[model samples]
Target: MGLVLAAGAGRRLRPYTDTLPKALVPIDATTTVLDLTLANYAEVGITDVAIVVGYAADAIAGRVNDFQDRYGVTLELVPNDKALTWNNAYSLWCARDLLSQGVMLANGDTVHPASVQRTLLDARGEDRQIILALDTEKSLAEEEMKVIWTSENGVRTITKLMDPAEATGEYIGVTLIEPDAAAALTEALKLTWQRDPNLYYEDGYQLLADQGLRIDVAPIGKVDWVEIDNHDDLARAREIVCPS
Candidate 1:
């Protein structure tokens, strides 16, 4: 299953997000972030996708039938009512039951080619119950969700609170959650949200790692991808996807 977290109201990307959710914002002339995401899943031969929607849920819900027909994939909409008040840890927890079947979870606001999913799916296995895509090439920034790993690739930390200098790579917001770790991961997410409703889902991974869950990192080398958080990022995304 391909799971997408698309609940947040992209306040930074406002006026554009004032009408449509961030995922529905266009990158290419005709393709939106969620469009590319669903296409990636289709390219990988994953036909089932579940999208967690809020903050303009109607926009996404209205497009479901068209997206399914266009991509040849089925979509299940998971509503996150607290999306305006709570962070993504809660948005993710809303799909615990669906995630128990194994999933390639991606952020709906991120735009990446099919190769990103292929790389993660290729590296996942029994031992690596949680696999995250890391961009080793990207320079660290305070806002980027950073990651540190052991020599064996076990994720040591994943959060935005870490100093940029201490990070090994930037998590690009895509992950593979194997069924074996789904229950524990769900519990960890719950704990993270309960502690602070403002925490990102990365905190859930940190909690899981602290409890001895081995989250592996898969470096998406030299890939053209962008997370659309603000206008600057949206500009970069257009260049990445519709470059002359």
Candidate 2:
């Protein structure tokens, strides 16, 4: 399977990124945010990785390439030149040729070993798209881009995180998709982002759900992942990964 690391302007994590990309910011003596995610995937048997780079992509590219050179993994590069303008769906679409069989999509800003393992394990038997959902110590808010399900069945509905119903929790930015679903999602992205240039990947997934696609939410029970949105997130994540 393939993995697409969504690349974009991390406007939320400023100042630190005033000089460096968020993904390249150091977490510890041994890892960066993106490095931890990449290493997690490697541990769980993901060999082929395609990282979509933009928004200070050169550093992301250099760091990942350096690691790949040392570790010998199949690390491919896909550029989201429009990352400044478009959302993550467009990033994955740019790398569709590398995802012919199927692929996993990840948020470059979040990293944790358990979270990576859970996403891969949960997506194992799925025949369709599987979006990773996490329940947490603090409930994810209505603006965090969440996923929810009402079915005794495993299939679910992913919304903009603004729906009144309390979700299991937030998206961990991990999604598994077969090639057909990936193609369908890209097509949906075309329609969704045509009128509005600021569309996110959630927009495409919502389009798929609206059209009756079987999008499964792979629930990861309160796990050890961290989403680096701001300085606090960075500090907290660094503490978790680099408690010295």
Candidate 3:
């Protein structure tokens, strides 16, 4: 099972989202951003999916229902209790029970390239969690997460959003986690929630990796993958996912 983070009001994506749920914002003639993402997941045989939503949860559920009616995919709505002052970590907590031992976690705002699905399917039962990493050989900005891999081997540690000056590339917002690591995520959240429930999943991952948990990177860059945050990204991703 995979968990999709769809909670939180699209504050950055204002006015337009004032009336419509951002997830329902269309990216093509017959698809919205969420539609494109969920449809692609279904295309890859991922039938179990939970989308954590907050503001406009009902409307998002309606969209999910519509998708199920049309595409016949299981896109359940998981409501986040605290979506106001939190990042995506809270959404993960809300969708916790929906996930299985090895779960795929993706941002609802991004349409991950279909090629990344192979990395996820291959990650099942792997020792370390897998992350879709951008090639470090490319010329990236100075503020990227420099990769320090052990070898070309399958197991390694991934430090996210590392110092860009010393980093080589970035994360494409696609990840696959092992069962134990998924359980560890819940444990790490229990510790942090005592202090702050608004923490992001990145914090737990970093902590677990620091504690010597292996985190592997699945290389992907050739396909078109875009993340939509502001209006500009929305426009850009629309073109990539639904090029006419």
Candidate 4:
């Protein structure tokens, strides 16, 4: 199964996101970030998907049948009542029940190809419970979610505050959460949101790592992808997905 965190209110995207959630923002004439997401999941044989929705929940909910029919996948919407007040740590926690199924989690605001999902799924193994898709080839920046990982110990840290020079790569907002790691991750996410409502789901990942969970990384090589947080990112995503 697949899980998507699309609950964030993309205040930076302005008028585009004023009535639509970031995931529902149109990247092309007819395709949305959510559309491409479901397409990507369906491409990799993940036909059952759950989306954590907030902000403009009704926008996505109203399109459930349309999306399911268009993407050849089942769409389930998980509502996050705290979406307007809290961060995505709580949004992600709302779908904790689905985590036990071993989910391929994707951030709904990211625009990328199916290959990124393929990369993570290909790296899955019995010993690997949590696998994050890392973009090691991309140049690091202050706002990107950076990670410090060693081949021997897996991911040591994952946070946007880390120095770009000391990071291994950027976590591209896609992760494979094995069923075995679900309980710990769920608990960590609960603790994260309770500790600070503004914390991201990555913070939950950090907690899992701190608890000695084997958090691994899969390099996505070189790819054209964008996290749509603002207008500039939206443009970049449009170029990546629908360049003329």
Show where candidate 4 strays beyond 4 Å.
none
Q: Please identify model 1 stretches exceeding 4 Å from their true place.
A: none
What do the candidate models score in CA lDDT, each in turn? Answer: 0.92, 0.69, 0.66, 0.93
lDDT of 3 by residue, 1-244 (tens): 6667777677778886786656766677687767766766777777777788887778786666678877668777777767766766666766666444566777777776666766666655535554544554455554333455554542333344555555435566667765666666776655655557766565565556666666677667566766676788888887787677
Model 3: per-residue Cα lDDT at residue 133:
45
Overall local distance difference test of candidate 3: 0.66
Tens-digit lDDT track for model 4 on 173-213? 99999999899999999999999999999999999888888
**Model 1 C-alpha lDDT per residue in residues 160-202, reported as the tens digit of each score:** 8899999889999999999998899899999999999999889
Candidate 2's displacement at residue 18, Å, is 2.3
lDDT: worst 10-residue window of model 2 = 129-138
What's the count of clashing pairs in each model shown?
0, 0, 5, 0
- Judging by TM-score, tell me the better candidate of 1 and 2: 1
Clashing residue pairs in candidate 3 (N, C-alpha, C atoms within 3 angstroms): 142-164, 143-164, 144-164, 146-167, 146-168
For model 3 the TM-score comes to 0.85
Residue pairs clashing in model 4 are none
lDDT of model number 2: 0.69
